[model samples]
Target: MAGLAAAALLGTAFASTDGLARTGIFGSPGLTENDTSEWLNTGAPDFREVVESLRPSDLPLPAGRSWQPVIDQQVADGQREPARMQATGVHAAFAHYAVCVWDGEWLAARQAGDTARVGRAVEVIRGVPSWPIFVENDGGGTVDWLRSIAEAATHGDEGPIRQHIRANCTSSWIGVDQ
Candidate 1:
């Protein structure tokens, strides 16, 4: 079960990168290491920059919707192509944050005395990404890392488990977890 959860999280991470690579914006042929440095200068690298480059800058949404919802709704509404949605600058950060949120929510479910909900979140989190490097490709063994955290949560060390997850996921798109 723990292995499944880690795999799901990692899978989401890689799928996000695959989305960007297919978008033709971030990983353009000429993107040197220096170019990556420049792109990092864009301040708060949300996926909206990719959307702004690909489509009209004036798409309507509520004031505080996350990038995933915007992109997901766009796909659901047939307003944009899957490729466009994947290409959003928000993909990488969103995926990273999603895993963090998934861990926190799952830990909460388990802590709040809802073991069933914890299992469900675990199932979905497993399904989403599989492992962390599937999203970022740091080393490998992210599955083992996730398993350790899950074990911690199962032991009622919810706070530390969440803190560990958040530390692994401090990215530019979403702010650090508070």
Candidate 2:
């Protein structure tokens, strides 16, 4: 009975919503170093610069609201096929950066006991489809670590949450290894 209950919980946790699978739990196949190098050769932006530019307020929410509409609009504009081909690597790097920001926000909110901010941060995290892709693209084990941070935040466990961020968030940006 305990095993069955655990399985049910896992199912619910991993289930896809709106056709998008929840990320950070299961490890997807990672990209090879060669693949990353080739992608970078396509003129990707500097990973550090991209990471530095990201702010938590730049993420969009479900209710037609965003902290920075102009930045979001720029992202939206890059979704075209031509732009996508050129900027795929850059976008992936940004995804990793976003996760790091969200993880920090979640931790801060948890420490402050700010439930509203916590929920908002988690919502932004859930909306990011890049986590899974990051894992799939050989980003790093930090992808799973980020998921663990999310789970810890949900359970109000600050210890592990802080530990994971300290251990993984600093170097979590995709393409950083390259």
Candidate 3:
């Protein structure tokens, strides 16, 4: 999966100038040239900025409804495009952070036992442009890995997630076990 170009995925667009996959925003510290020992040791980087960006500035969840409406409005308004994602190291962070925020919403709903909210979150995520990048090959089509991952995370089960990380890991600097 390393060095995959935008063309590798049908209709997918990569912002990389070299037409190669670049690391950052997607928890690919191992794929980076930075100090591996130092970087990996710090664990996952703080993504508060990306999470905060998804918050509605002037809109709050109305009454008993979920935040999906606001997120949907943002999407329809073209405000949640990939170019609007966290850009600490990416030119456009939408592709990366959209997954993060959606995963968070999914997990939160699952944990709260809110089946309706979980379904709504999943529906919202279905519209995210970058979601296709998270799919993995299966027999007939592809697996929506993010949904499985969110399920795993909500259950505090890292085995499946680790298997995915190792199987798809393209970085040599940091060990998948790390």
Model 2, residue 129: C-alpha shift (Å): 7.5
- Give the per-residue lDDT digits (tens) of candidate 1, residues 118-173: 77656645544344333343235555565666565556566655565646543333
lDDT of 1: 0.42
lDDT of candidate 3 over 1-178, digit per residue (tens): 2222121211222243332212243433445321121111111122233333445332222124344432343243322222222222221123333344444545566667887877765565444423433332122222345456656655656554455445543223112231
lDDT of 1 at 11: 16
Using all chains and alpha carbons, the TM-scores for the candidates as numbered come to: 0.43, 0.43, 0.29
Off by over 4 Å in 3: 1-92, 129-178
Root-mean-square deviation (CA) per prediction: 11.9, 14.8, 14.7
Task: List the candidate 2 regions with Cα displacement exceeding 4 Å.
Answer: 1-89, 126-132, 138-143, 170-178
Write one digit per residue (lDDT tens) for candidate 2, span 91-162.
443454455556667666666788898898777665553444444544344455556656666676666545
lDDT (0 to 1) per candidate: 0.42, 0.41, 0.36
User: Among all windows of ten consecutive residues in candidate 1, which has the lowest summed lDDT?
Assistant: 34-43
lDDT value, candidate 2, whole model: 0.41
Deviation (Å) of 142 in candidate 1: 3.4
